[model samples]
Target: MDVSDILASQISKHKSILVEKDVPLDTDVGFLTVTDPSVVDKESYDHDREAYLQSTARDGIQHLLAALFSLPTLPSPEGPLAQLPPPTTQLPRAKPLPKPKPPTKWQRFARAKGISSQRRDKKIWDDERQAWVPRWGWRGKNRDEETQWLHEVPANADADHDPSKEARVARKERTAKNERQRLQNVARAQQGRTTATATGTQVDRKRDINRTLATTRMSTASMGKFDRVLDGEKKLRGVKRKFDPIEKSVDAEKSANLALIKQIGNGAPGGSSLKKVKRDGLDSESGGNGGAGGVVNVRKAVRFASGGQGAAALARKSVVGSGSDGRQKRRGKR
Candidate 1:
């Protein structure tokens, strides 16, 4: 036979048994009493009772399945398997614990009488000090005598005490004086003025001069004309003027250029006139020299040439006109 036919026959058998036993269809079999009058012995009754109870428990589960699956009656043992309710899709949410309320006087009293509410591990008894000390650690207890002395506070110590009125007034005066002095120093520096020393004594100018003379030993033998004059020394004749190396070199060049011009003026080539010689000399002197000194020398040489007005004009023109040539050369390059 097919599987469905077999299942149908088995179910029909179970239904027939249930009907012959005369069991109530709607009663919860698990709670039903044994009403059989033929049962006499207690053992037999108990045996029957246990069997019935087991059967009823099984039937109760089957009935629950039938109801959940929308069946008209209880499922037989051999009936097609029915699905169980999707086991508690989610667990019931737990409620939060209520907040603790503050202790009443009675609670506090109870706690004082050896019923501690707070954790007791924070403090412990210190054997050496004979005191209740913190569990974490103690500070400064094992320190040396010197360290204990340094850490000690005086009996009369008052950190927040105000100063006396007289002390406050004196401090204000001192601060004001310091501020005024600072402002005066700033003003002097801005205006390029020298500040005097704190003692207010006049500086000894003569003393400073005496000190310089002693240290430097400046005397008439090593002095210039200006220095000698300041020192009240008698002026002497034919004492070649003292000049720096640069000035000495410039003087030598000027003398050489003058000699060259004099030679050129005295002996010119056949066709070249005195004016032409003078012009040539000036041009050579100016070209060889540079700076304001060259322009001065050119003018001096021209005046000495005896060419009069024309020579002076030519000297002026040469000095001024050279700038235009330099500018024109720069423009041409661009």
Candidate 2:
């Protein structure tokens, strides 16, 4: 008889397998593809494959039975059929492992939000090395840079008051005016102290007049030619000169149009003014204008191509080149 006829006849003698009939005949035996040798060790599988049929132990016979059950037909007549014993071994029923519990609400929320659990629990930034470093919310060193709005807030005033919002805005405007007065007062106080330190009390009255005259002269020099300076351009003007709106408005409009960005609140975004302040070619390095002493030490570079010997001397001596050597010397001493 042919091998196909012999196999068909033998398979018909046994009961059908436990799986559903609608499952493809090929699919029933396909689970052998997922058998990883690493699970039961390669050596053990190889040993069972090569061992003598008579010497086959309990586990080896069990594996052989499993192979038989998974196959389509009983072993062939000449394929160890006569030597094999009747199938009596059964695999132990495995208890299903318990399912893991779902994560807590906070954990689920953090995962959904795409933030760390620890960060969600804590405030935005943590200070390190004398710098206010932000941990979340924004990526930049200056939080204001990331902000969309720049509300003119009153210095030292509460930002979140509803009833006092108009008053707060007015307060900020008043403060700006007050700053000019405060600057004048400070200049007068400094000049008086300088005179007192260098000369006798007899010249104190005379020194006051001289100081006022000097401040008036400085104020005239500081005022810019502009009628209105843009916020961006205004910030760029430090102690060197007040901003000139006439010179800066065109530049500010150009910057705003470069990027079509939306503001966050009522205020405008991007503080392009702050960015311009950084780019105005001022000496940004340490001790450029203002240092730890809260004093701006301005040193105009003397180009050797020009008649710079006099300028160089003035820099070295810390003297104002206005013929009053005694006052210059006193200013240097302070």
Candidate 3:
């Protein structure tokens, strides 16, 4: 009744699913990849390239699938599904590490002076307040005099001189200076790949700072009219107002303009026409107004020559010479 011989014949007809190698195949079922470290059979590969490649791929796939199936299966709606384990193989990062930020001007100075930075607490202890107050900003310890109700006036102080008012003014000035410095630092940082050791490049930095100062000055309320007057700053000059003759009628004005145009077009006493002279004058006045006939942009040329300071400043600079005193004065003015 036993069919052991028949069963043995059927089993022998099929190839075994198991695969063995010199080096054990590494399987990462999560990634569905198998690392075959064993050397390939050169003789078999050379004999049949396609067959060799197919067989190699087949072995890797079989190893990956076998590892996946070994995992414990959970019940699912359609069928049991085995969960893949986390990948063991380490992969390189797709992106490169970020570069370090360029150091600020203060940082460079600190480095040169061999000064190490120490963390300072934002809050400072006040003996009068009997509580911690901020070092700066929002009822800060720096504004102790300004916020206090009572103040002791000095014997030498003027009757109108209020210590509280003076203190408030001084605090405002201090804050403004700090903000200006911060803006200057930002402008310098924007200049690409600067080294801490360079001295010749400071003029370029000062140029940026001067522009920033001008922009911030206009940014204040009343278009910087009410803001503190900077030292050596030019006084506000009123524009000369002009008006056409009120006695002349519209018809007369049009006729007069036409007559003038006709006179100019008829040419001057010299051989050349007055119209050419007028056109030349206009072109000269246009400066860098993007006129097609403009050979050289006067504004850009002046800016480049004076290192961002206008023609008037350049004239003053030439007159004053390159002495440290004059240079320092120009910097302070900006």
The most accurate candidate by lDDT is 3
Clashing pairs in model 1, backbone N/Cα/C closer than 3 A? none
Per-residue lDDT of model 1, residues 200-291, tens digit only = 33256665875676444444555543452446634443448986465457778899778878787765444458777777677665554532
- Measured against the true structure, the TM-scores of the candidates, in listed sequence, are 0.14, 0.14, 0.34
**Candidate 2 lDDT over residue span 70-187, tens digit each:** 4554467666332333334344659876755445444567799997754333333435435555543345333432242445555776756443456456655766777776676666
For each candidate, C-alpha RMSD in Å?
33.5, 33.2, 28.1
Task: Give the C-alpha lDDT of model 3.
Answer: 0.78
For TM-score, the strongest prediction is: 3
Q: Model 2, residue 48: displacement in angstroms?
A: 14
- Candidate 3, residues 1-334: lDDT per residue as tens digits? 8899999999999977788777899887877889898888899899999999999889888877878888999999999989888878778879998977768788899999999999899999999779998998887888888878889899999979899999999989988998998888887776555545444577788979977877777787788889889799975444589987788988999998898788777644454567678767666645434454566555576677678977778767766775445533443343
- Which portions of model 3 miss their true places by more than 4 Å? 1-96, 128-131, 194-334
User: Can you tell me which runs of candidate 1 are displaced by over 4 Å?
Assistant: 1-45, 71-93, 96-334
Error of 2 at 127 (Å): 27
Note the Cα lDDT for every prediction shown: 0.52, 0.48, 0.78
Better of 2 and 3 by lDDT: 3
10 residues in a row with least lDDT, candidate 2? 27-36
Q: How big is the RMSD of model 3?
A: 28.1
